[model samples]
Target: ALLGQQETNLSDGSQQRVTQLLKTAEPGGLYGAAGDLSDALPYRDRPGGLRAIAQVHDRYILAEQPDGLCLIEQHIAHERVLYERLNDRWQLVPLTTPVVLEGLNEKQLEQFERLGLAPEEFGPNRWAIRQAPEPLRDRDDLPDALLELSLGGNLDTAQVAIACRTAIRNGTPLDLATLQTLLDDWQRTRNPRTCPHGRPICLTLSESSLARFFRRSWVVGKSHGI
Candidate 1:
């Protein structure tokens, strides 16, 4: 049975309002919004085989490839890069100003020490960071990073927390140069398809995929299957 509502209608006023809202809304992840990127593509000989073009919603990077356009989630891509580096070995760096964390229970504190993180309890339910993993030491959100360390016991989880804390967040503004540097680093990583949390770092919209969306003759054929 067709149980769901068959259709819904929007009043003229409602439709107008929706249109205005959409116009103001940021383009979240349109990889090929500029369209037909057969020219000005980069990194044709690079390892990842993607040429970054622009950033959308400050969270995803748009790249051009031979097949079509690619959209890369910025935060997750950086996380995967960091995770692979951390898994290889520990690299600790001292913090200029120690970070403090609160609200952790006994088990959580033990977990940090087990992972070789230097945390000293100050007042009740409070701890101060003496040193941090090299990748995370310079992060602005060091306190939040300490909390991430307490998430699990094994080295893998530790890497996850550190990577999450250090990577760039949404709403960040980056120029073309910075985006290129980021793409270069991402390509250097051994695994670029998925993050440590198993989230997709990149997505591709191939030429055939775009053709199908537009109902082009190249894909649908002149006869339309007769």
Candidate 2:
């Protein structure tokens, strides 16, 4: 399948040895069998030259590399994906309840108004979740979450920070189906490059970049060396 390629090549003997090693690397031997067998088997193939393959199983997402195995928090990935989608789709669903915020000083209120949220939308005394965005409907703790945000002075930046925290936390585990859905949604995002807080959502390292990290070309005094 040629998952990836490298400038260096393994000898025929080494390739044969790797094939032999893979024969014994059964479902339980190295990478556990959990997801669809079709997706699982080829990821463990020897001749494919895979650098890594990450998959979500029943209870965990595992990353397999030649050096070692790693268990990743699938839920965090799902949350990031979901949050990105929700943020993009915000205008699609109007606020179900008009949220009245209280406790904001004049400056805070001014900031909120500048951001397009009116005092009426928030309600009297700066308190009340008369309506909330649809994505947050299923989150039972949302009211309390909004209250905390209001208490903190209703600064626009602070409000966004609170929304991010309420969206999702790291370390949640997701099933294969959920992971697939999350990834699919993520691909659809216009700026899948970064999260709402301006943090990078994912990173990519090409073969050339990896070679520089190891100073491979530098050792040979090549033109493109590190």
Candidate 3:
């Protein structure tokens, strides 16, 4: 099949390498022949099957996976982590100063309280949050969070709002240790592919893709006969 408009004009040497790469790129071989961690991911492989190289643009976590490279959006990854935690454990912590959330109607406040927000009437058009989910206790965007929850009446949506508010925001520089910890926790989650909003958290670039970009032949094994 034709690759694309740009690929049709490759030089003879580049075309040869591309052909070699395509022939060696096998399908359904991600985890190798055994299709198990034993063969696919050896003991000496990078921890968690990947290593955090850097924080790109202070928002995404640039990591190197065993088979390729990946970029993880920090905010969404943390949000997914927090959402699962809140959903399963339902942990709550008291706020030292009750958070006053404005722009919520009385009925909305009632719904918020039912969803574990623990908000009480503070003043006109505002509610004081005595206790919040552990994830939300440190967030300063309570108003926005409350607003996100106000529109929904289900527990699932409430969890999303709490997670979004609690997760580390974009542009916040994370140290290598912290980034690794976050990625480690993220890898353990039941569903780490997407966030609460259904946004992809990780973008992967396979080794084959890299080879194609560099116009180099990709060898299947460690053999160096060529």
Candidate 4:
């Protein structure tokens, strides 16, 4: 099988290390094998299995798995993780310093109310938000990505919007430890492939595919499952 062109080509030496990693990469069971694992994931026998290599364009995380390599869009992956967290425990709490929204149309105002933002009119064209969903608190952008979801008029819009805003942006830099933690949370999400807004979050290049691409004889079977 051919890996997507977007798949990063790692060194054969890295591939060899991944082969060694397969011996330790635990299966992703009901919860997750790496859920409580520490950040020291680059070592040969560390838990969680995926060996994070480096960032691709500061947007995607490149990790060596037992298969081959997995490129994960950090922002969308975090969105899925946050969305599930919010869906499981949606909570509204008062902001330490209230957020104020200005120039909100009636629809925007109504949407805030519906989402339990507790917006109160402070003055003309301004509403002070005393309380908001914990996921949305301190967020600079209101979940403005909700146009399509709101048109559907479903409650799921709330979680999706907040998750998108709270999630790590594509350009953010993440260390290996942080990358491993993010992957851990991402693995535990109900849907790991797509974010709440329906964007793909993960991509994989199987070891077999990499071998074929490199036109080399590859052996050893292990799954550093991501």
**Top TM-score model:** 1
* Backbone clash count for every predicted candidate, in the order shown: 0, 14, 0, 2
Stretches off by above 4 angstroms in model 4 are 1-47, 140-153, 217-226
Worst 10-residue stretch by lDDT in candidate 3?
Answer: 34-43
For candidate 4, write residues 115-226 as lDDT tens digits. 7665788998877877767766665553344332233344577778678778899889889889888877777666665678665565666676568777665323434444
* Lowest lDDT block of 10, candidate 4: 35-44
**Candidate 3 C-alpha lDDT tens digits along 69-135:** 7788999999999999988988768879887877776678678767777777777777787776676
lDDT of 1 by residue, 88-111 (tens): 878777788888787878788788
Index of the highest-lDDT prediction? 3
What are the runs in model 2 whose C-alpha is more than 4 Å off? 1-87, 91-102, 114-117, 120-126, 147-163, 203-226
Q: In candidate 3, which residue pairs get closer than 3 Å at backbone N, Cα or C atoms, i.e. clash?
A: none
Tens-place lDDT digits, model 2, residues 71-171: 33334444455565455554313456555555667765564455344445344555444444455555666665544444444343444544475643454
TM-scores, each model vs. reference: 0.67, 0.44, 0.66, 0.66
Which of candidates 2 and 3 reaches a greater lDDT?
3
Off by over 4 Å in 3: 1-47, 99-106, 116-128, 218-226
RMSD of each: 9.4, 16.1, 8.9, 11.2
